[model samples]
Target: AAEHLAATRAGRRAPHRVAVAGSTYSVFPVRAGARTPQAVGVSREVRETVLSDWLLVVEADAGDWAEERLDLLYGVTQLIAVERDRRDAARTVRRRLAQEVLELVQTGAAPAEIAARLRVAAPVLLPGLGAAPHWQVVVARVEWEDGTAETGPVAQSLLEEILVDPHATGPEHSDRIAVAHTGDEAVALVPLPAVSTEHDGSETGVLADALLESVREPLSAGLDGDGRVTLGVSAAVHSAEGLRGA
Candidate 1:
């Protein structure tokens, strides 16, 4: 596998046939580890401008490996690449929105301008939630003992994962969280329905406490001794100025 990966990195586009244990296998390079290959498959180079240092490889059963199978693997790999690109684009847009909002809040931009930006951002972050819903801010920081891990992206991803309500119904419910990274801290903007009977304006602490309840044990296990995760949840804010204060 290492040799085939090297060959692909060195500009070898053709598939390689190799023996593993007692059987013959075909190998292909994949763009990233995220692209899960079948039991038997081919690998393709992941490229943007210059080729990435990694390849996507798929492996298949030796007896079933044929020209048609090869074509099928290639097609599947292409589809995965397309999906990867789409995800990257969506992530870029979300990150930009988060960053912009963070900057505006930090710089004390006009309430009208900040409100306009939030209006634009509402659909992407909160999706099906209607206009001007109450919002909560959750700040998370992950600290590693050796400072080796990249905490910003990791915290952003983890914050999104943690903010999702596993029992919630509807597609848009899971998409109601948006997180931005500033230095080592991840800031999450969460939207709540304007009219939840469970809590009122001054009771955002209830919501905040609930956010960490289910995720705390699992996340603590993952952090273990190597790192620590701390979170500060703010009260619900109704307007752009309120968001800045939160």
Candidate 2:
């Protein structure tokens, strides 16, 4: 699989045969894995210039994937690419909204104006949300060992992945967090369910410690020699004015 991916052009989506030691997978893409040569499968790559790209490999229990089946697989890839584009477009809007909101908070905009903006943004940022949620802000920083890498988008992506609700699936997680990045820092505005009927904006202590402990080892392994991720979580706040303290 590594060899096949390495051999393929990252910028192209054309179907190509995946050749193995003694045989070829053809455009049907059934030969790269350990499965028997007769196992039915299809492979396709979805290329995205604006967002992350992915390869799709579909396997069947038995039989061969006839050449005629390639058309169906190709259609499936098209649908997937369409969905990817939709999600990417939505992410761009979410980021822009996040930037505007963050700027309002930092600049001390009128509370009524910010509240109105938040109200307008609620449906887009948290789809199908029942009631308002208390908001928490987490800021992340990525520091490279040699200090040459562009860390803003990297940290932004990392925080998006890290903050996703673990119980949800796929793009559903994308709508739940608004992240904006500048320079080497990414600020994530996360919404948590209101814990009680009444709430005071008190400091939530040690969020960073608990989060750091859970993520450090696995993150360290993935980083290997790249860099480190640092995170700090603020006290949950309920109103637009409260966002300043958050």
Candidate 3:
């Protein structure tokens, strides 16, 4: 299997690839030892350096290898770190934007101002969201065994996971979903394409179902018997008045 994978990826081999359920990772040998072999995985715990020439994980049987593997491991580690950092930075920007919106809503800021903020933050926080012809809100709550999941970043984490599907739109619509966390509950602001009045609005139900179906199982895992999760889907709002209602 390992040889096949290496052959498939342009003759580049990762001698000791670790498998973790749905994910597979590559580790390259760094140094040779009497018994143990020094190697490094594609992952690194240090966020500051983000990449390292040193080995990440030392295994019991690393064969003698040169710096060639070390260079490959370094490049892979850097790529992983860059992706992770991009995701983290995007999430932080979204959270800050959400907080700003919440405050503006409290301070009686004009809808135009709020909309401007959203437009600025949307693409940066949730990529692939173009001009929104229509939008909807999704509200959800999760009750955990110790209630920890409901209180902290877990709610935001769960919410992001639920709304991660960018293509969760109707056949007639050309838009995607953008989600953000508020407080104990997370809210999704989904965009829609132009719809004819002749089309039944029930198409939104399909989206809601998709959201529910994707989250039900993973949510069940994150939650215990003490953990309870409930969600409400607001009617699709084509206008500003409808958004206010949601």
Candidate 4:
């Protein structure tokens, strides 16, 4: 299977079936690893592309393996490809929202305009979170050893990865974070539940600390030894006017 993966990376596109330990497995090139747990699956060339080398292998009964099941697996893989494309397209729109909102705030756009944009962006960025949610601005920077590599997209990708919570039920539920890249920095716009009238936004400071704490280890490892990631989290802001200061 490893040899087949090597061949695939070397530009070979043919699928292969291999017998291992009395069982046969079907292998196919994938754009990314299967999110769901399967009897067999593997991913190689993780950083090669947005969709890297994903090897999907399915276990087969000794003599029960049939063309019908093989065809079913291929059909499922095609459905996964479509879902991946949809997810990528949706992410692009979310990133664009973040970028446009950031630009509006930085350029001192009218608060009404910013608020309007937020209204439009709420459904996409916050999903089921709510219509009027408090927002936090998290700024992250990646410095590489060579200092020549582009950091915006790298930071953007890392931000998205870090923001996902394992306990979340679905992609939309876990995707409360949206990131936009400006210059060499990636800024994440995180939505939180609105504060009660009795409390101020200071509670969000705790949330900010927790965000950093939760991601510190994984992010450090992802940056490796040659790069460093620095994060700055702002206090929660409930209004467009406060977003700039946040």
Q: How does model 3 fare in lDDT?
A: 0.48
Residue 102 alpha-carbon offset, candidate 3, angstroms: 3.6
lDDT of 4 by residue, 1-246 (tens): 454444443444335566888877756544433423241233533222221233467675313446565556666766776776776677887888898999999899999999998887887765664448788888878777778767787678767765665555635633567789987788888877685442644335336577788866544444445567788888788999999898
- Clash pairs, candidate 3, are 40-56
Q: How much lDDT does each candidate structure score?
A: 0.63, 0.60, 0.48, 0.65
Q: What is the TM-score of each candidate against the true structure?
A: 0.60, 0.58, 0.52, 0.61
lDDT of 2 at 188: 85
Of 2 and 4, the candidate ahead on lDDT is 4
TM-score of predicted model 1?
0.60
The candidate, 1 or 4, that scores higher on TM-score is: 4
Candidate that scores best on lDDT: 4
4-111 in candidate 3: lDDT tens per residue? 222223323334555555655445433222012233222331111111122234332233456675455555555655654565565665566666755565567788
Error of 2 at 15 (Å): 19
RMSD of each candidate relative to the true structure: 9.6, 9.1, 10.7, 8.0
Please report the candidate that would top TM-score against the real structure: 4
Question: Candidate 1: worst 10 consecutive residues by lDDT?
Answer: 45-54
**Candidate 2 runs further than 4 Å off:** 1-86, 128-130, 169-171, 195-210
Error of 4 at 44 (Å): 13
By lDDT, the candidates rank as: 4, 1, 2, 3
Extract clashing residue pairs from model 2. Answer: none
